[model samples]
Target: MPIPDGPTTYRELAELLRGRIEGGEYPPGEKLPNIEELMETYELARQTVRAAINQLASEGLVRTVTRKGTYVQARLGRRRVRRNHVVTRSRAGMYIFPAAAYPDEPWQTHGTPHRSMEAAPEVVAEQFGVEVGSEVLRRRRVMSPEEEPPFQIVDTWLSPQAVADAPQIAEKSTGPGGYLERLEEAGHGPISWSEITRTRMPSAEEASLLQIPGVLPVMEMILVGRSGRTEDALEVTIRVIPGDRVELVADLVRDASAQWPLRTAEPKE
Candidate 1:
């Protein structure tokens, strides 16, 4: 193999490897070739190969074990389906629906809630467009899914008016229905919900709640729901989900090709 004349940036190498991995030539959980092998094959310096692998690892495309070699991390791809729902490409593309109607009881029957009637945090205040230190309805909950360990730890902050109107939220338990549903019932329909998904090693408290051993990475879903003119609304942060069990779905629609070229001007010449 011959090394290219110009400098070989890590981005270039990462793109090459990423293409191979996405193309299924290097399937998920498959160990990548050793550094020496990669250097020999690409005819690049060892440093270049290391840099490329580092880039991949940072992007969560690969994982490196102490004694073991580097292996591909399982990548999740989502397919849009319907409003607030998505078909995950993994798990054979299972459909995940949004939380339906408010619940009459707590999501988990075993635990208590932590509630505070105080000023919201800066982040929360900014999101809700309220002044810092303004009174807000704050509740923290640890919810278990079925027999599984506590699957999610949610910290929810709602506008004072939003909560006062729904008295059920005054308790430390989950509302009779999901919080979002309750918001809808209060006449604040969500114009959009933005989700930021990632995985990280859980904190000590999170690990204890989830009852998992070691530093197993857990999936985090942060959602900000906005109402009114698709520009603003209440924001909520929910974190920690068992990676193997939780699924996220989204649906998208586009005008069909038949609708293209709506009107063509007549030939003037």
Candidate 2:
């Protein structure tokens, strides 16, 4: 095959392959041409071809097996996680923690949370208004679709005051509605939440646990749960979700003064 017009750099090669994948030329689960074949066809070096494949892999478009070769990965539809702050209650009148947002999909926790009293990480300490390494309650839960690669890891850190007020929070199960309810019951009722979302490459441990390539970015949502009583944050929940698996959606409503359709100005020639 003649080399296509344009730059023959690895980035260009990646774009060409990306077009093929998106255009259905290389359907999901289909094996891509071997590096040698791609090198020959594109008249590029083996390293250039490999780099292109690596680019696609990083974008979650392909997976490279040790011996089998690279294959297009099946797209995992992104689950939309609403930014709604309203606390919800189940039909059984239990406060429901928003875990898996996918409706009708069976999602489960990987195992019982690993609960321990450990020094707070920098971020957690900041939220707790304590010096770094201050002892705090920590609970980590891995959530996933049944028999599937874990998609999210929720790490809940509670300030010393929160645990002192609601001891049940440190227990195996804070029955119905989870710890939020327990905290509320302990005079921390009417809890409010604020969140910050950022994306970064996953840590090695995170990549191994989520079963995703380190190149794939992950979103870290820092959720601070506070109350009216004091300025200190009561709890901080950090949600780590793979880039390919989840999307955050929030409804934005214009203020009363902002009209939907603006009046156009008259032409002044």
149-169: candidate 2 lDDT, tens digit per residue = 688998899999998999999
Clashing pairs in 2: none
| lDDT at residue 129 of model 2 (Cα atoms) | 85
**lDDT by residue for model 1 over 41-117, one digit each (tens)?**
77778889988887777555776665677788666432222235432222433222344212232356237777888
| lDDT for each candidate structure | 0.64, 0.83
Candidate 1 wrong stretches, greater than 4 Å: 1-110, 117-126, 129-136, 164-168, 171-187, 190-192, 229-231, 244-269
Candidate achieving the largest TM-score: 2
Per-residue error for 233 in candidate 2, Å, reads 1.1
**Model 2 clash number:** 0
